[model samples]
Target: MQKVRVLIVDDSALVRKVLTTMLESDPGIEVVGTAADPLIARDKIKLLNPDVLTLDVEMPRMDGLTFLDNLMRLRPMPVVMVSTLTERGADVTLRALELGAVDFFTKPPADLANTFMDHAPEICAKVRLAAGAKPRERAAVSKLDVAPRLSADAVLPLAQTPGTRGGTRIIAIGASTGGTEAIRVVLEAMPPTAPPIVITQHIPAAFSGPFAARMDSCSAMRVMEARDGQPIQAGHAYIAPGSQHLLVMWDGAKHVCRLHDGPPVNRHKPAVDVLFRSMVASVGAATIGVLLTGMGDDGARGLGELKEIGAPTLVQDEASSVVWGMPGAAWKAGAANEMLPLDAIAARLLALAHTPVSAAASRVGT
Candidate 1:
C-alpha cells in the first residue's frame, strides 16, 4: 500500500514540527508538507495534493472552520481536524465532522511535553482512516442506503402481541470512522419508544460529552455518555466515554453500564468488542447487536461471540459504510446475521426488538 501522504497545518511552529514528525514516523504515513496557516496550506494543497490533511481547528488569518467550509464546498477531500481538548473545541470539532472532515484528534494539555508521541498511534490511525474515507460535497453529503425496507412483521408475527411475550429488550450498537453522522441518522430515525440503546463509538475523551449532546439534540430519544454503574433505561441511548471500555452488566434483573480501564482492544479504548461481549453474557437473547461503519475489525470477534450464543447481529452493508472494515470483517466471521444499509438496520431492530422474549429466543437459533 502507498504511504498516506499528509500535510500538517497549524499556527504554532512547534505544533507543525511535532505533528509532521509524529505522522512521518509511521512507515504507513509520509508528511508531504507543513504550513503555518490555511493560506500557506491552501497553496500547498494545490501543489502537493496530499492524500490527507491534519488541520488545526484554530488558525491565524483564516479560521480553521471557515477554511474547512470553503475547502469542502470547492474541492472535496479527506481532512482531519486537530482540536484542543475543551468544551468549546469539542463543539467546533463536531461541526467540522458535519462539514465533511473524516475524523479528529484532540490536542493534549499544553503541559504534556510529548503530546504527539504519547498519542502517536491514535493520530496516525485517524490520518489513515481519513485518507481512505470517501470524500463528499459539504452541502450534498451522500444519504445512507435504505434499500429493501423491513417492517415489524418481519421479526414478530402480527397474530401475536409482542408486549405479552418479552422481557426487557436492549439495543447495543458500536461504530467508528464515520460513526458520528451515521449514529445521528440512526437515532433520528428511531421512534420514541425504541428500547434502550448502549453505544460504543471510537471517540476521544473530551469529545464524547459534546458528541452525545449533539446526538441528543437531533435524536428523539435522550442520549448521553455512559456513567459508570448507570442503569440502562428505555428511550435513552448511552454512549461509552472515550477513555473507558463500556460493558453491559446485569444487576439482578436490570442491565447497567460498566466502565473498564483495561488496555485498548484493537487499539480502541471504547472498543466495540468489549460492549458486544458484555451484552452476550448479560442480555443473552434480548440483545440486538448493530455494528456500523468503522475502519478496523474491532467488533468482528465479539460479534461472532454474540452470534454463537443465539443473539441477533446486524452489520452496515458496504454500499453504505464509510470504510466497511468492522462490518465487513464481522460478516466474514459469520457474526452478522443480516447485512443491511444504514437506513434499513433501524427498522429491522425495531421489528426484532418488539418480538416477545419467547419468540425472539426461538428465532435466535436461526
Candidate 2:
C-alpha cells in the first residue's frame, strides 16, 4: 500500500506539531505539511494535496465548519476534525460531520499528557479509513432540511399498530464510519408508526446525545440516546450511548433498553455485535435486522445469529455505503437476506413489520 499523506491544520502551533509527530510515527503515514489556519490550509490543500486533513474546529479568519462546508462543496475530500471534549465542541463536531467530515477525535486528556500517546493509534486509524471514503457534495444532504416530516399515521397508514402487549416488534440497526448521516437518511423517511427501532452507531460519547437530537430534528421518529432501563416504545428510536453497550431484555412482557459498562467487544464499546446478539434473546423472530455502512466486521457474526432463528436481515449495498466492510462482512457470512440502498431500507423494514404473520410464515414474502 502507498503511504497516506496527511496535512495537519490547527491554529495552535503546539497542536500542529504534536499531531504531525503522532501521525508520522507510523511508517504508513507521511506528514506532507502543516498549516496554522484554513487560509494556509487552503494553499497547502492545493499544493500538497494530502490524502487526509486533520482540522481543528476553532480557527482565525475562517472557522473549521465554514471551511469544511466550502471544502466539501468545491473539492470534496476526506476530513477528520480534532475537537475538545465539551458540549459546545460536540455540537460543532456534529455539524462538521453533516458538512462531510469522515470522523473525529477529541483533544487528549490534560491528565494524560504523559500518556497522550494513547490517541495516536486511533487518529491514524481514522485517517486511513477516511482516505477511502466516498464523500458526496453537501447539497444532497442539505435538501433533507425540506423533506416533509410524516406523522406516525403517515408512515404505514394501512398496517396494524406495532406496539401492543407482548407482541411489540423490534427493528435493530447497527452502523459505523459514515453511519451518522446514513442513519439520519433512513430515520427521516420513516413514519412514527413504524416499529420500535434500536440503533448502535459508532460515535464518541460527547457527540451521541447531540447526534440523536440532530436526528430527531430532521426525522419523523422521536430519536434519543438510550438510557438504561428505558422501555421500548413505538414511534421512537433509541441510539446506544457511545460510552456503553445498549442491550435488549424482556422487562416483563415489554422489551426495554439496557446499557452496560462492559469491556469493549470487537474493539468498540457500543459494538454492533453486542446489540445484535442481545436482540436474539429479547425479540427473537419478531425482529428486522439492518446492518449499514461501516468499516470492519463488528456486526457480521451477531447478524448471522439473528438469521439462524428466522429474522429478515438487510444490508446497505456497497454502491451506497461509505466503506461497506460491516455490511459486506455480514453478507459474506450469510447474515443478510436483502441488500438495498440507503433510501430503500426504511420502506423495506416497514413492509416486514406490517405484513401479517401466521404460524407457518417464516420468511418475509417481499
Candidate 3:
C-alpha cells in the first residue's frame, strides 16, 4: 500500500520538527514536507500534494481558522488541527472541527517533553485515518455559528401537569465528528428536569472541560467532566474526560461514574462502546441509548448489547449526520429501535422519558 503522505504546518520550528519526526516514525506514514505557517503550507500543499495536513491553531501571518476556511472553500482536503491544551484552544478546536477539520489534538505543556513522546502513536494513527477522509461541503457561516435556533417541528409539547413517579430512567449518549453542535442542540432542547445523561464524545483531554462548560452555559442541564466516584443525578450530564474510559457502575442503591486510564478501545480512549457496554450491564432495561452523528463504528456492537438487554436505542439518521459512520453502524446492525433525524431525536427522547412505567415496560417486552 502507498504510504500516507503528511504535511506539517506550524509557526514553531520545534513543533514542525517534532511532528514530522513523530509522524514519519510510523511505517505507514511519510513526511512529505513541513511549512512554517499556513501561507507556506498552501504552497507546499500544491507542490507536495500530501494526503493529509497537520495544522497548528495559531500562526504568525494567518490564523488556522482563516486558513482552514480558505482551504475548504478553494481546495478541500483532509486537515487535522494541533491546538494548545487550554480553554481557548478547546474552543478554537471545536470550531475547527465544525469548519471541516477531520480531527484535532491538544498539544502538551511546553515543559512536558515526554508528552508528545507518549502521544506519537495516536497522532500517527489519526494522520493515517485522515488521509482517506472525504471533506464535506462547507456549511454556510451563519449555520456554523454556535447560537441555538429553535425549530417548531423539533419542539416537544409542554407537559400539562406533573406526572406521578415512574421507575428511574438512565440515558447514555455517544457522539463524535459533528457531535459538539449536535449535542448542543439536543441538550438545549431538553427540560431542566430531564433524566440523568451520560455522554462520551471524541475529544481531547484539555477540551472536555471547556466542552462541558460550553454545554453547561447553553443547556438547562448541569454539565461537567466526569470524575471518578461522582454520583449520577437527574438533570445533570457527565462527559467523559479525555484519555480516560468512563463506565457507569450501579451499586443496587445508586449509580456512580468511574473514570479509568485504560488502553484505547475501538481507537478511542473514552470510546462509546466502553460506556455503552457498562451502561447495558448497569442499567439493563431501564436505559435509553442514543447513537448520534459521528465517524466510525465504535458504538455499534455495544448499542446492540443495549438493545438486546431491552434498552430503547435511537440512532441519528444519515440525513442529519456530519459523518454518519457510528449511527449508520447501529442502524445497519438493527440495534436502533428508531432511526430519526437530528431535529427529531430530542423530541422523541422527551416523549419516551415521559412514557408511563407500565407502557414503557410493555413496549420493551415487545
lDDT of each: 0.82, 0.81, 0.80
The clash count for each model shown is: 1, 0, 0
TM-score of each: 0.87, 0.89, 0.77
Give the runs in model 1 whose Cα sits over 4 Å from its true position.
Answer: 111-113, 139-166, 358-366
lDDT by residue (tens digit), candidate 3, 1-366: 899998999988878877877787777888989999889999989999988989999998999999999999999888989999888888998878778887877788875354675677667767876776566546501111122322111211222322222257878999987788789888988888999999999888888988998899989989999999999999999999988888887756788999877667776778888888777666666778999987778788778877765678899988878677899999998988899998899889888777754556467536
Best TM-score among the predictions, by candidate number? 2
Q: Judge candidate 1 at residue 73 and give its lDDT.
A: 92
Q: Tens digit of lDDT per residue, candidate 1, span 1-366?
A: 799999999998888877877777678888989999999999999999999988899989999999999999988889988899899999999898888888888877774446456777677778988887886566311222223423222221222211211257888898998888888879998877889999999998989999999999998898999998898888999999998988888777577889888767776778888887777667776778889998878888778776666667899998787778899999998888899989888889999887775676577556
Taking all chains together, the TM-score of candidate 3 against the true structure is 0.77
lDDT of 2 by residue, 1-366 (tens): 799999999998778777777777777889899999999999999999898899999999999999999999899998988998888898999888778888888886584343445667667778888888887678201111122322212211222222223655689999998888889889988997878899999888888998899999998889999999999999999999987988887777678899988767777778888787777777766777899998888888778777765677889999988788899999987788889999999888888887553321366433
Give candidate 3 misplaced runs (Cα > 4 Å): 1-5, 24-31, 46-51, 73-75, 110-120, 132-166, 229-231, 251-254, 260-264, 318-324, 356-366
Q: What's model 2's overall lDDT? A: 0.81
